[model samples]
Target: MATYDLIVVGAGALGAFHAYHAAKAGQRVLLLEKDQYPIGATVRNFGQVVPSGLAGRWFEYGRRSLEIYRDIQSQTDLTVRANGTVYIASDSDEWVLANELYDRYQAIGYPCELLSKLQCLTKYPLLQPDYVVGGLFFPDELSVEPEQMIHRLIAFAQKKYGVDYRPGSVVVDCQSNYGGAILTLANKQRFQAGRVLICSGHEVRLLFPEQLADAGLVVSKLQMLLVEPVAGVTLPGNMLTGLTIRRYESFQECPSYASIPKPEHLAELQKWGIHILFKQAIDGSFIVGDSHEYADATKAEDLGFHTQDYINQLMLTEARRIVTFPLEVRKTWAGFYSQTKAEIFEYDVDENIRIITGIGGKGMSSGAGYAEASIREMGL
Candidate 1:
């Protein structure tokens, strides 16, 4: 039987980074994935690393994650791009929230630029002039090609750090022994490890159903679409709008957030949790999305696999109101992720086994830094 210092189940962003850090710390690490490649929230995301959208420790974690991502990119190509992020305001209420959040970021010494109406129009010509009142821009953020980034990161870790990575290896059982845990694969092959970390996303029912049922986790289904590349149009960075200004967590933390009246007309949009954001890919196509729908983790099936056309049209309707550019949908799909009332769900089944999942949308922005911190906290 082969033995390892750490066995990380699920090679998504969280698990892969944990394995990378463990190996970087000189521990023998094994990374396992059920599918031939990662096809979860890690890849099915907007790939926007905007710390500006988060608050508190998550915001700090996101800031650190940016640093870690750049460090890795320096060593190899991880599809990391420093294109920056901007939040555009359409009305006085949203405009107030933007300024308030700017003050909050300023107090913390984070760098951001407040743009005038003309500045916003000058920077992004595709934006409808009347739709944009002003904007706030964060220059240190990034946008990545989600489909390509994870594969490159895994390959880099294998070649440079000597981390053992196995795909299509499904773990059926994990039992703790005297000093370590034994992991049994679907084929009945077994491996031993000093500790096992499960960052398996929403697939927790397979390993520990009782804990997952009582963990208060909810699965969120999001709908996003890709626009076919538009000729003579260029959007360089993450473009967040008025709806986003009203919906993001950072804005909720602002002092004026409570007093700002919610528009009664937007009730249906709020019911579905729709927020419009745009990011132009290197290939000139635009990635736009998304709306949130929730169900208990146990009832994830309630949120079916089919994408809702009415929901997509609601998004496209609002999207058209915001931008003049053509939005011919190239593709549409649903992405699932888990979350809890707490920032993350971390349960220690025993000293040798821990289950960590339910990071919500913060995975892309904060996963790397949180994993590094978790390793030190675990003394692994």
Candidate 2:
């Protein structure tokens, strides 16, 4: 049997981050994934890394993650797009809310600025004047091409840190032993590890069905889309809508929430219209999204494309207010994110076996920090 210090299931954002940290710590790590490449939530949505959307604690982690991302780019060949982010407000009320958030974030020493609609248009000529009343700009935010980022992270872990990866290997069974856990692969191959961290998002339940029953961890399906970018018009940076502020804990927890109009807040929740975040790929194509739908058993046929259309329309309407680019639909898809009632779900199924999941939808932004914390907790 192959033996290692740690075994990580799922090669998504959380899994990759955990594997990277474990190998960096000089632990023998094995990362197993059922797919040939990551086809999960990791690569399915906008790749914006917004520190502003996270809670205060997570925002701090995001700041650290951004630093790691910045340093890793020079060490690895991953394409890190650190263009920053702009939160656009469509109405006077939203502008008020944006100013309030800007003040709060600035008070916490976060780099953010409140800009008038005219200032935003002057700064980014592609912006449409009528759509934006004001904007919040975060100079430290960045984005990456999700596929390239994951591949590069995995390559760095293996080549530089000696992390072993078993792609296309599905873990069929897990048995806990005294010192560690034994994982049975689909091919009947067994691997032993001193510790096992289950970063496998929605697949966590399938691996430990009985244990997760009491955890209230369920699956949420999110629909997303990609749009062909306009030839001459390039977004100055990433963009977020005002609705996002209402949904994100960072904004909701802030005293700025008092500035948001009650009727507007209710309307947003009724439509589930959190802010729309947009990021342009290296090729200049923009990835847009997303709407959430929760379910216990999510199947291929159950995925919705019309939901993407609805979200796209909403985004375009908002985008028209900020920029004058003609967008053409390129592709639409859906991905599954694990949802837990709690902020994070960590449990010890056995003394040497641990499960870590429930990053919600903030995996890309906060996964690295959580992975580091998880590793420390495991003493690996």
Taking the tens digit of each residue's C-alpha lDDT, what string does model 2 give over 79-177? Answer: 777788888877777676677778878787989888887888887776667767888999888888876788888988899999999899988898888
Residue pairs with clashing backbones, model 1 = none
TM-score of each: 0.99, 0.92
Superposed on all Cα atoms, the candidates' RMSDs to the truth, in angstroms, are 0.8, 2.4
Q: Compared to the true structure, candidate 2 yields what TM-score?
A: 0.92
lDDT of each: 0.92, 0.77
> Which residues of candidate 1, in runs, are more than 4 Å off?
none
Model 1 lDDT per residue over 187-286, tens place: 8889999999999998867788899899899999999999999899998889999889889899999888899887886778888999999988888888
